[model samples]
Target: MIDTSSFQGKKAAYYTLGCKLNFSETSTFGKMLQDIGVVAAREGEKADLCIINTCSVTDVADHKCRQAIRRMVRNNPGAFVVVTGCYAQLNPQTISCFDGVDLVLGSNEKANLLQFLSEKWSGMSSDAGRNHLHEHFSVKTKDIKTFVPSCSRGNRTRYFLKVQDGCDYFCTYCTIPYARGFSRNPTIASLVEQVEEAVADGGKEIVITGVNIGDFGKTTGESFFGLVKALDSIEGVKRYRISSLEPDLISDELIEYCGRSRSFMPHFHIPLQSGSDSVLKLMHRHYDTALFAEKVRHIKSVMPDAFIGVDVMVGCRGETPEFFEETYNFIDSLDVTQLHVFPYSERPNTSALSIPYIVDDDTKKERCHRLLELSDRKTMAFYNRFIGKEADVLLEKASYGKAMHGFTANYVRVELPVSESLPEYDNSIRKLLLGDFNHDKTALKATVI
Candidate 1:
């Protein structure tokens, strides 16, 4: 119904703001624009259209979105700015108030951008008239499972394939459920086919990423274990990694699948949020600290060398100093390889904002620093275990200052001396001798065989 004939020679540039899902959506949008004869360019470059996929996870996301729009307008004075994603979905009116913002498309309407743009182009006589389309293009959220795969850019050995979107859990202090809507997952067969295509395109690794990866099978009655099994069965994939998963979703079958499957990496990133049961209850998380610890113990039992990463948020409401100490000590006692510490940032319309006893900023900073220091120690210890042992590394690229750097199977950063084999070794798994303590003990330098 929309005319694309007017956009034949036009160009567009895309910018992504948040998680892997945002990147995937940006890439999909880029492909859609490209299909309609719109050339893709880098951000800050002169282009007819600038598409920005925004995020609303943190309070700073709004500022970043606005700044990006300003920068785009500065570089290309007359460019049309199309804003979509979480920030646009939740705060379209606020985003539309910006000076250079020409279109504010919500998450549901992002797919129809090209169609809308084409329709606008047919109606507008001059560039000045196109701004009116912003008001008309505003869309209400609809129930549709539009699985558009993101195009992989950059020299990434691994590609993040977003097989799912949205979240069902409305945890206090979290705005994801409101921003992304309910959980929706693609069919296992479709995902397997995507993995095959990625493997064929020379992607050495594929990361299964989503808002709530643990809630994958809840909607369709297809378990996360089933998805893992299907992806593990795919041929030509060197490695596959699962992104953030909730503690309750870490089942015995999933652990067993990782242990037995050749392609699945022995690295799991499960979010624990808080270690204190009382704090976790206040946060409205599903699982307790005991259940979470049991899950970690079980993973270690199955794959002892598995790189376990835990997510902890500090300074949530009602988290006392003693509670934080409990969290720090609990993480220190665990066999986790690393810690991803997030200093809790309160967002608008979240339950945590209403809760009393919010920790001071200084106390939150201190707690974050304490956990980061602990993380340094834990990561170094994990790296030291592989010292003097040969690790199969998928060499990525040559660093400008340091030598070639890549990741091992267990997700350790390994750097090797620059050599003739470096180019051929890129994206290929090769054996390397991991050396001891560099300037930072956490990372290990290597020499290729």
Candidate 2:
């Protein structure tokens, strides 16, 4: 066993990049340190330890991870730096080569971070050189199988519950499976217990996050729909939003349940990496354009005002000009609210590297810009549809001396101006009328009913 007293009175700083799952995991790491008497470092205060959770979805994400590591080390000056997450799992040696990186933990090892810290906390050195990281620090991606549960509110009004982890799908041009390992998840009963705990801690909103949340039954025999049904039965959770799910895994029964359920919001986020059937075939995607469009049509058939977000990738290995045009036309016809468009980046050890006809950088930039513009138009149209409608908004705490902001059940951003007549809106649900766009046009202005 590790000694807990070694961590007492130590101040630590945390830096997290990437998805909501990474943020949820970092928050759990903070709670683990706090239990051992380590406090968070205040502004302008030097810290004794630094924890960085990184992402490796794209080459740009990897670059940002390295930048964050160096900046944290420079700011903390003699702190024990620990790096983990997808980047650390895939490229531990590259990260260890950087100056002042004390340890690089793997995906499975992140769950036992406190034990690793206890072993190194005594007589620790912050030297830039020397063999501080051992070969045993990271396990091979195939060896990772543990599922660690995390339910925490990290600087947000909504609590993120990590019910699942890892991915089994190995799409061409993707490195997530190699970085996150095979699909796995906890039992429905255990996840329900975690939700109850969050509710006990006064959590009003919960977002179900995971790498492949739709593949929730790989480790356990429970289904994702079973997990959803169980979570909706919890008493104190006023809202629940699903982060993203595969189009093939979104069953008709699940969509119907969310359409009628009391707590499940009328919001959905699905990924359509390429709208062109030929490009999707090259990427080895399970479903094609026809199925994806039908899914969108079905969602709208049940809930007309639902907010649908999509993920699109431009400039894959074999995406030609004709294929790009096909993708644009298909997306322009969808009822999606927003688009998350990103240019494809080459990653090591992926099948896409061998494909012919790679796109040029200039062409990729143009395609990304075009998709983003279409996304803006669709988002504005969706927001305008609800301008005169009444909505029940769950207000969040004010920040930056600005008016309070919140989201409706369908995930529309609403801002309420600060005034004495307004009730204490922090963490309170208020019925309001959606008005015109605010000054910057970021969110819709709202007035209390």
Candidate 3:
């Protein structure tokens, strides 16, 4: 075995990009480093090793990854850098060309990082050794064939549990299906045990994470509802939230279970890429506007206070004025809490590039702005409804301006001034009486009852 004594006293720092799923994976690897005696780099200190978890969801996302890599290398010139995740999986050589990068591991390769690092560090300390290390460091993603389970831990109150991995749905505008292989997940038994682990680690809430979470158990001969039902029985976790589910994959049984389950929270993030059936078809999304609206109505009927977040893409090939109008009007009619509006960017190697009639840049911006305005209205309306009601909020330590902040069980963002008794309540939940909106309406101001 290679001697790892040199790694024992070193410092490592991590930077993550993209979704909750990526954050969870980064946290997991950071903890693994901790286990081997490497601690996190202290504030204002350069790390001996730097890890960059990447995303390649869009063209801009790719650019951001490049920028982050360069910035990390510039700051910590001697640090060995490891670049991994979706961007690395899709385009490894591009990341490998960076000056300070010692290794580039793909999605499948990233999981077994300790072994790869051990092989590289077998002796000879200088640039010559590193150059030899670099020669054999490319771990390509032949295919993602298994689920790599992970959970987030730290000072945060909410934990992200990655129950599923990969995606089968090859949407025309998305590169996820290529970066992450087929949709796969662990059995319900495995995930329930992971939920128990998160609770034992003092997590109050758990967010189920994956590329396509709702498609869990397709290979295991189980359903998403079955997994939810299993997790609901875990005693210590206070609440659970679905990261984001494809509209069609969301079943009535799942919604109904959330309505009655004591452990599940009243929040749902369902993606409705386009409200126009024609647009949906072109995007290769599985559901239409009618089905999405029906699902929204069902959730509302069962739990009126539930927060529904929708994801929408503003522009795509063949999205004309008529189709754009259809999406806007459909969203306006829904009883949602907020909208995550994304202006579609043509990704290389995707089916969308060949589609006719590309939406102009100006049109994309206008549509994005209009949807953002609608989002603001929807978010404020959602917060307005709960005014004067008591909300149970899980507090976080991150200072929001001059005050502390947290999210209520219904997912309402609330702000309050820090108290002398605040330290005792970090990462803990407390009940508060909701007051009116704050001056800017970004979050509701609440008082402890």
Candidate 4:
């Protein structure tokens, strides 16, 4: 073990991969290390310690984790490489095999990272027995009961407040349940406190994020609607956004409340993996296409200008050209603002991988391109409807091209002319006059009122 007495004022760098929950947990861990006088350092800069928070969402995640570790070791050969999170919990042995990975802490052990480091550095020789991270590691999920305020690095106009963790759905194509374990949530009172704290910290908007946010409070008996109502009562928070939610969980009360809630933003992201009922059944998704369409209609009936984002996974097992066309047509017929299209990736131990009629890589690529083209059209049409209208934009920082950017309550991306008077952080809002979409509809440039 390296001696802690000699490590005072040492530098540390952290790299996080995966969902908002992982980002929040990394921020919390960063703060814990900071309290012990470990200063946060840049990625390429030499540091005494490096912590990598990993993900296991897709096959790409594994490749990315290994690449990141190799790069970090190359940059800081002397740094103690510590790996943690879902990937580490699921495949500790694989990560432990890396040459520079001096320590591997699983989910539960992550909270005790500082203690582990101290013990390792205090007169503990780097013997073969002490160096075997796989033998000393433990993986277990902690019972989360409190909300943590975490925002992305750099100047983020919006922050993601992790209100829930873990999933119980066990969908055929998902390994999130096994990687994250059972569902858990912070108490309503705790979440409200965190929201207030975020607002106090100058966050204009908060997106309630989680692994399976729809299943929130199932163990505590509090409904998602109840959480929304409580959050609405909190003053100073300008906008509240719900991350991706299940269609069946979108209740009538929640839809109506969103229509009238002053704090709730007019945006919703719902996942609809497939439109074919047979495919959905085999995928183990709870709701069918009709039910999903009904939920979208209900939300639109109340808030016509609401921005609806849909998640579609194409070219999964059993997804023939005909089956895919049905999904494409359903999405085309919907009044969605945008689409998050993902080509299905086979995951280990997933039922979908073992199913027959696996889609070829070429087919998946073609389907992905088709849906993306449709998404561009839908997004352009959605943005066109608001052209020449005035939107209350929470002004953020100047971008790479010296263009100032922000977002409206409806979640439209707006870029405004750079001005000295515009607010830099959470301190300013501008009444932006919307303009025509640029050649690429990814961002809409606007004029400041």
Q: Please state the error at residue 301 of candidate 2 in Å.
A: 0.6
lDDT of 3 by residue, 212-316 (tens): 988888889998888888888889888888889888888988889889989888899999989899999999888889999999999999999999999999889
For all candidates, the clash counts are: 0, 0, 0, 6
Model 1: residues with Cα > 4 Å off, grouped in runs: 1-4, 42-44, 121-133, 136-147, 151-155, 399-402, 440-442
Question: What tens digits encode model 4's per-residue C-alpha lDDT throughout 93-147?
Answer: 7788887787887665776777788875433332433343433375544442223
Give Cα distance to truth, residue 171, candidate 4, Å: 0.4
Q: Kindly report which residue stretches of model 3 are placed more than 4 angstroms away from their true locations once superposed.
A: 1-3, 122-142, 398-402, 419-421
Q: List the residue pairs that clash in candidate 2.
A: none
What's the C-alpha lDDT at position 215 in model 2? Answer: 90
Give lDDT tens digits, candidate 1, residues 224-316.
788988888888988988988899878888888789889999999999988888899888999998898899999999999999998899999
Off by over 4 Å in 2: 123-136, 420-423
Best TM-score goes to which candidate? 2
Q: Could you tell which candidate, 2 or 3, scores higher by TM-score?
A: 2
Per-residue lDDT, model 3, residue 49, is 81
TM-score of each: 0.93, 0.97, 0.94, 0.91
Indicate which candidate wins on lDDT. 2
What are the root-mean-square deviations of the candidates from the true structure over C-alphas?
2.4, 1.7, 2.2, 3.2
